[model samples]
Target: MDLSYTDVANRYRRQTLSILADERPLSVSELASRIVAHPSNDATNESTETQVRKARLALYHVHLPKLDESGLVSYTHETGEVTVPEGVADDLAEIAETFRSQMDE
Candidate 1:
């Protein structure tokens, strides 16, 4: 499934915020693991390493760029480190809640 730019941006923003809320910059692999480990409403399958890999690529190549453009996150491609922008954590939390709610519905 193809995601629109806004969709991608929102996902990246929320993920970045969630990661940064922990107060540490994360490598791409670490970020991917966190995202996959994060609980969701979907009950059919759990996230796997391959799923994480796909998410990482999507976030790194597409979503991160948009988030960077919006100044919602700062990323260093060379080291695969990502930091969430200031004041975006609440919004990301809200978005994450909404996503979970939608999946439950």
Candidate 2:
């Protein structure tokens, strides 16, 4: 929890660090697309919002759970919200850029 993304071993965590650079909570579906789409492409529409992927099961079943377990985010199945806890340092935004660049590659 204390280590930065460069020091952290899990790439998923690093990827998520970048995804959450916006420092706001997002619905599960939005999180999935943000994981794959370039930041410039992050647009939310009620019709297309749920269209991030088919059924969005992978995000529900896989990624969010992994993130939730680490205490990095708060996921509420009932509310469909994934929240980034406060108090994390702003240096993480750099990790987000790094992860974004890596995703571009």
Candidate 3:
């Protein structure tokens, strides 16, 4: 199957992916909150509850399904947990680490 790099390029999805690079098995609500708090989404800072709700909806309806389909993540709806698959996590973590290092330079 062709990879949907578009899934990774989307703003919410990108933020989700970036976030999961360092953390996984996060509760849906917690993940949504963190996404809202990400630097690029600072506009959400002033509207925490609203952003969290929107992010939760987006995550449940769009982002998580796409990422799960890509085999990059596993979303357990019953448990409300999201986790990066072992195979993909290492690669993404490495990329995230490198990007973080470059930003620090």
Candidate 4:
């Protein structure tokens, strides 16, 4: 639930926030696909179905719940949907960009 920099600094969480920033109200599975497909995700091959499945599981059971707890995202368990709260997406994108730039350096 910590909304500290370290929380969003996590790769999966950061990616989730950034994706939600642009494409609000995505299902966790869809978010996982985007995360896996993201260019910065060097940890796995984006084209792999196994990788997507793994990412989806991690997002659903770990990242999304944590982000939801932190109030950065709204996650509906039954519907499997995730959304950033109103007016928060731009800020979330900025934070994610900051981290991305730092990591790039």
Candidate 5:
């Protein structure tokens, strides 16, 4: 199934926030691994390289654009590096915490 950029971004937002909370700067591959290994509360068993690639594309093409538009995060495409904006770290932390809380529920 195909997902809209916004759909993919929203679905993976918590996981992205979690990774950014612990690791400020990350490459796409690093982010993909983190998402696969530590998915959100609603995650399924569809974790694989292909899934990771789709997630990565969604992040780059969909999620990151939204985050950038909101000034919540920034990335350097050439370097494959991403970082949560200074003032948005707390927001990302909250997002991560929400995932943790949901997982515990």
Candidate 6:
């Protein structure tokens, strides 16, 4: 699977991918909170609960499904867990680092 930022350009998706690469097997709510706290997202004045809620909804209804379909992640809705497939975790770490640097620039 091409895990390139070009292929996964959405900021939320990119942040989710980055977080999962480093911290596998995160609960959906926890992952959403991490994504919201990730530096790549512009700081907002919104309450933490609101930010987390929005992130969670997006992950559950959209990003997770797309990433799961692409085989980059394994999301179990019943358990609300998200994990990077081991086969891709190393590659994802490398790719995510590269793109994250570029994003910082």
Q: What is the TM-score of each candidate against the true structure?
A: 0.64, 0.62, 0.82, 0.83, 0.74, 0.89
Q: Which model scores highest in lDDT?
A: 6
Q: Against the hidden true structure, what lDDT does model 5 obtain?
A: 0.69
Instruction: Mark the regions of model 1 whose C-alpha exceeds 4 Å error after superposition.
Output: 1-9, 41-47, 85-105
Off by over 4 Å in 6: 4-7
Q: By TM-score, highest first, what's the ranking? A: 6, 4, 3, 5, 1, 2
What shift in Å separates residue 56 of candidate 2 from its native position after superposition?
A: 2.2
What would the per-residue lDDT of candidate 3 be over residues 22-81, giving only the tens digit for each residue?
877798899998877766554534568988998899999988998888887899888889
Tens-place lDDT digits, model 1, residues 17-104: 5556655567777777777666751343644867788778977897777766776667888888887656665565565555556545
Expressed as tens digits, the lDDT of each residue in 19-89 for candidate 6 is 77778789999999998877767878999899999999999999889888888889999999999887888
Model 5 residue 12 CA deviation (Å) reads 0.9
Report the poorest 10 consecutive residues by lDDT, candidate 5: 1-10
Sorted by lDDT (best first), the order is: 6, 4, 3, 5, 1, 2
Q: Per-residue lDDT tens digits of candidate 2, residues 1-105?
A: 565333345544565567677756877777666655545343566544455573357668766676676566677899988777665536567656776776667
Candidate 3, 27: how far from true, in Å?
0.8
Cα deviation in Å at residue 87, candidate 4? Answer: 4.2
| CA deviation > 4 Å runs, candidate 4 | 43-47, 103-105
Cα displacement (Å) at residue 80, model 2: 0.5
Q: Over the stretch 65-98, how does candidate 5's per-residue lDDT look in tens digits? A: 6766666668777888889877777766766676
lDDT of prediction 1: 0.64
Q: Write down the TM-score for model 5.
A: 0.74
Q: Residue 15 error for model 4, in Å?
A: 0.5
lDDT of each: 0.64, 0.63, 0.77, 0.80, 0.69, 0.84
CA RMSD for every model? 5.4, 5.6, 3.0, 2.6, 5.9, 1.7
Give the better candidate number (1 or 3) by lDDT. 3
| Residue 45 C-alpha lDDT in model 4 | 38
